[model samples]
Target chain A: MIENRPFLKFIEHLVLILGVLVVAFPLWMTFVAATHDAARMGQVPLPVLPGPHFFRNLDVVLNEGLWGGDGSGVGYMLVNSMIMALLIAFGKIVISLTSAFAIVYFRFPFRMGFFWLIFITLMLPVEVRILPTYEVVAKLGMLDNYWGLTVPLIASATATFMFRQVFLTIPDELLEAARIDGAGPFRFFKDILVPMSRTNIAALFVILFIYGWNQYLWPLLVTTDQSMYTIVMQIGRMLEGAEEAPQWHLIMMTALLSVIPPVLVVLFMQKLFVQGLTETEK
Target chain B: MASVTLDNIQKTYPNGFKAIHGVDVEVKDGEFLVLVGPSGCGKSTLLRMVAGLETVTDGSLKIGEREVNNVEPSKRDIAMVFQNYALYPHMSVYANMAYGLKIMGLGKAEIDERVKNAASILELTEEQLERKPRELSGGQRQRVAMGRAIVRKPSVFLFDEPLSNLDAKLRVQMRVEIKRLQESLGITSIYVTHDQVEAMTLGHRLMVLNGGNVEQLGTPLELYEKPASLFVAQFIGSPAMNIVDTKMHENGNEVTIAQNVSLALGGGRLKDRAGQALKLGVRPEHLVISEEGANTLPLIVTLVEHLGADTLIHGHFGDDKTDLTVRCSGTQSVKVGEKLPITASLDHIHLFDPATEKRIEF
Candidate 1:
């Protein structure tokens, strides 16, 4: 970029364009497949371009549900996924923010011990302790519900650690000033600490939203009811039909629909997300 | 306004490191007291203890009649301006100043009135009040900080080197403004700084501290004209006082300063301790150029600094080659390696006991 040589510029553009194609090619294929009917999609050579039956496929997917999985419409599963994702994201942020605040500001007995206890959970993520977590969830009568889907996944050590780092970067004098200003601990946290870390909260929300939205394994284990199914788990179910061939067009359409919410979240909050991750605004 | 009293105040850290020893000071109502000391001398610690940010480990601290050792900073009715200004970066200037008042549960109209009044006093513009701290220049941010303290209308104002971050020119300007503001408000204030000039100008009375102990507490003129100890003598003056070792004359009427040069003690001031070894303290400006005489010592000039209004000549004197600095008029031109005869008036000479480092009365 600094040198501005013609050959180097050409080479840079060529590499960038190739990278874009590499990433976007599969997404383009999914769109084309969603626009065509299953008959055209299963042809010897798959259609490269979108077909005219896009709206018909969309209506069928919206109303009739995937043919192979539970017959609950895609709309209902989309609603379920949206609820689960929002709950998980908001739950993780609230729990982690308060925990990080308590860890950073307060000095109680065994404070670091508590911090390390939370930190140790990072090494034992959902995959490693799946059986024990599942046993606890089942024993608590939380199975086949949103509680089982979201609550078990909400205590995020990574988010807590990130917020702790952000709080630590704020000057100690700010706390003293707040204390002098007659602001109690809770008031200080609300008026000063929370607002100062606005971008960081936004950034974490985007990441955690996507993380919740894409949850598959835990939802697959917890929910048995058709109405309780999330979009991500439904896609896995759509691929495994015992008597019928996989509906490529409808599956692709659901895949395309499932990707939209998280993508929109990223697009809307991209500025704050980048700012939160890259810089401490204060 | 209320007086602040510290009765045998002490601070011992949890790690067993005692930062502030038992020290007592009484600041009268509407008085400006400055704590001046070098780094690690516990000046800031004492100020923070007064502000209730630090715990009072041993003794009673009172504001007016109330013992505030256990009181919260906000309830104690004290406001402190930090060394770094510590303005809330997210809040606008108006909000920053109004924060404390709002917390005190003042009505919206009252908070608005107080904030706007303080802004006018500090000369902060309406536009500036709407801007965040980071958006303003350093001086503007400093004014906003002062505005914050003023809006509270607290009993005491504690300033911890608030002007230390400013450039030299701005520091002088703000120093005068702060003095004027304090005078107009008639509020008791405790200011901390290591800069002697700021201490001399800002405080009605100055407390010079060293190694966590109070060295002297007196007016600026009292400290400069008669420093109680050697530590204070050098610390209070710029370019420092020149200290040299000497012995009292056997006759009790003269003191031998160098190998051969001797000064007559006209009043026989040291007659009680004749022939005893002592330290001689002389301000550079007090020494004047003179012809060779019984009181005059010849100095070999090593360096000459022309400071526009005055010339400072760094030199060594007599056979033993004692180091000395002589301040003279700028019109006088002197070169290095030149021997100049210097003499100090008998009244201008200060004597100290070498063993105790305490100044002796003539």
Candidate 2:
């Protein structure tokens, strides 16, 4: 279908330009809301210019919204969410990479069965098994605990699959060279394999980081206390409590703050992501 | 220095596919042996077995005084240069050269010294040492791969079609360079290549493998001048040795093409079971341009590939002989459709029993 007059030329560029603006509009609107109060934010056309309420809104967010009014009281929930997401991302990447390496490089019994099992998980979304997972987490005494938030979603099948695909393309010669150079499994990985796989690792880092930060259902079910709630879980509570009338400005501002980390990660790692993917294929 | 001995090496894949049979080749200390064959000939598989990359299905592999069949490649003290250069693309030339040394926990100064020495010998300038493989040309990447192998000072070196990836001119240059390097270092090396010219030039002794069996093992000139079988004779030369169907007649001599076009042979008659269907094998350069003498065959030239130094005349041997290629010096100006009688010295002719497609027993 893309064979003739492919959408990679002048016309496509124009469409792409419009596409960028379309995506950026909501994000820009979030930033604009962060600068204004509820009145100006909820208007028909939406605020697009600088306003005096930017610092004022920040004061409100930090004061009553995030830190609970007292200057000394920084609700510890923010730190909890930050730790949960960071640890989950880190844990997921480590597990995925190691498992991926094993699945791709080693020849052992039941290898094909294990690989297919992991691959089948990729097609089954986390939403399908969320209730059963939550029941298991409750029985393990993991409710309102960090383990509950991170453990269930820590093993990312997609990242493992991606890493397996990446590692498969690595020249067998490289591994043989390492072997000849007196490098054992660990040394080979540290000195050669990991360095060659920078791009793949970088790509997986972004994927796992985004997946962790965007986690809503698992964290929502596991954390009963506000102190253990993640940013996404907090967003869910905030939107739910609004009932009939919502504080769109405060919600938008919180969302903008939540999105900043992942967006920044993607922007900074884009070069690495592209480079790693290309090198893996090469 | 080490002597590598492969005793009854066999390779069978997961699907019950036996790629290599009971193959045996012993390489002496400081020897340069090349495993040469056509594609799918299992030559590379045999070399990988010696390198400990392929598992020995039934036999034993010993390096130096140790049985390396179950040993890891690292502990075996071997260095391999791959067909694609396989120079760590991320590493600079200096790092590529020094990697094995650095990983072995050599001192920084020692690693630098060895790298510098290899670079100097390879004629890589200081500026070139800082560049990555992508930045370097094909020839330079190949040199860097060599430098990496050289710095290891391993007991044995393994080369797997290292020159196959280079252009023709670069391949020629690298072939001589590798031979000279191997000679100067006097390291025991096993080189694998399908290019017979490379096998001839670089090897001290050549092992010609087919269907996983060693068809012949001898000095390059031995394999060239006296190929053990019809396979070896046809495989070891360019334009391939002209293999034509002939017949074994009464007495010890065999008639080639017909009685008037007969070729004399020293090998006695074989029973039909001996596959006595006679075949004539002659190198292009051995054929004389005119048919005045015995052992000469007249041919109508179909095409002439004039390559300055030599001209290859593609022709037919008889109405029955479909394809025959003759090689002569460039001085001859024989046109296509012109009949030329080429005389071959009786001693230079190789006789093959067509039924088995093997060289006759003399």
Candidate 3:
């Protein structure tokens, strides 16, 4: 990057173009596949360019349910996914922020012991403990509900640790000054700590929103009702047409639809996200 | 507005590390008192105890007539300016100053009025009050911190080395402003700093601490003129008081600093301790260049520092080659390896017991 020789510049542009093509080629293929009808999609060599059925395919996907999957339309599933993602993202941030605050600021017996206990859960992700977690959810009568779709994935140790690191960087003198200013613990948290960590919360919200949006296995295992099916779970179900040839056009359309919300979230909060991750302004 | 009393104050951590041990002092109403020492001398801890940030492990603390040993910091009615300013970075200067009043549930109009009044006193502009703390300079931030304390109108003001964060010139400027502000407000205040110059200039009275003990507490002039112990004598002055070892003369009227170089002890101050080992304390500025005589000591100049207003001559004196510094006004033409005769008036020469480190008096 430092030296600007012509040969080096040419080599650098070549590598960058190759990297961009490698990453974007699959997305281009998905867009192309969604533009064509099912008959053309089923042929051996797929269409490399558009086939003029883009709006028709989008209408079919939005209005009518996928032929091989559940009869509930993609619009319904999109609403379900939106609710689940919002719940999970918001729930995780609230829980992690409060827990991190308690762990960092207060002194109690077994304080570090409790912190390490939460930290050790990082080793046991949901995939490893899915069966037991499912059993507990079912016993609690939370199956086929929004709680079932979101609650099991809400406890995030990584987010808690990130927030803890953020809180640690804030100077201790601020807390002392707040105390002298007659602010109690709750007032200090709400007025000072929360506002100071605003960017950090926004950044985590974007990341966790995508994490919640992309959930497949947990929702698949819990929700038996078609109306409760999230977009990601619907995509997985649509792939399993037992004896029929899968509907490639509608499936690709639904896949494209599911990627927009998370992308928009990142786009809107991109500045705050970068600041949260990189800046220790205080 | 109120007096603060510390009666036998003590602090011991859970691990049994005692940071402060049995400090007792009373700061009178509307008086400015400064606690000063080197680092780890427990000045900050003692101040925190008064501010109710640190719990008093023993004894009682009082503000006005109330015993506030277990009171919370907010309930203690004190406002503190921290060493790093500690202004809330997100809040505007106006909001930072008004925060204490808002917490006390003052009306919005009253909060605005108090903030504006304090801002005017601090010479902060209206636009500056609307800006965040980071947007201002260090001295401005320090002024905002003082404005925060002023808006509260607390019974006492606690400053924990508030000027330590500024550059040297700014520190001096803020020191004068702080002194002026304290006088105009006339609030009982306890300021903690390790800088003796700040302690000397800003304090109505100073408590010099050493190793968690009160070495001496008196007016600046009293502490300078009659330091109670060797520690106070050495700690209070600039360039430090030059201490040299000696023994009392057999004649009971002089102290022999070196072979054939004895200073006559007028008034027979050390008559009872004749022939005993002693320490002689002399301020660098007190020693003058003199002709070689019965009362003068010889100094072989090693280094000369010209400070524009005064000259400092660093040298070794006497047969044992004890180190000494003689400060003289204006630049001197003294050279290295030159032998210079130095002497101090009888009243300026102080004697201390070498073992106890306490000043000796007739």
Best by TM-score: 3
The candidates score, on chain A by TM-score, as follows 0.97, 0.85, 0.96
Per-residue lDDT tens digits of candidate 1, residues B1-362? 89999999999999999988988999999999999989999999999999999999999999999999999999999888988899999999999999999999999999999999999999998999999999988888889999999999999999999999999999999999999999999999999999999999999999999988898999999999899888998898878889989898887877789877787774775688898998888999999999877667889999999899989999998777899998987757899999998988877787888898898887
TM-score of 2: 0.91
In terms of lDDT, the poorest run of 10 residues in model 2 chain B is B267-276
Off by over 4 Å in 3: A1-10, A68-71
Q: How would you encode candidate 1's per-residue C-alpha lDDT over A1-282 as one tens digit per residue?
A: 699799999999999999999999999999999999988987879988999878988898898876654455789889999999999999999999999999999999999999999999999889899999999999999999999999989999999999999999999999999999999999999999999989999999999999999999999999998789899998898888547788989989999999999999999999999999999557
The lDDT for every candidate, in the order shown, is: 0.92, 0.81, 0.92
DockQ of 1: 0.87
Cα lDDT tens digits, model 3, A161-251, are: 9999999999999999999898998999999999999999999999999999999889989999988989998888788854788888888
TM-score of chain B of 2: 0.94
1 or 2, which is superior by TM-score? 1
Query: DockQ of candidates 1 onward, in order?
Result: 0.87, 0.60, 0.90
RMSD of 1: 1.8
TM-score, chain A only, candidate 2, equals 0.85
Residue B72, candidate 3: C-alpha displacement in angstroms: 0.9
Provide TM-scores for the models. Answer: 0.96, 0.91, 0.98
On a 0 to 1 DockQ scale, where is model 3?
0.90
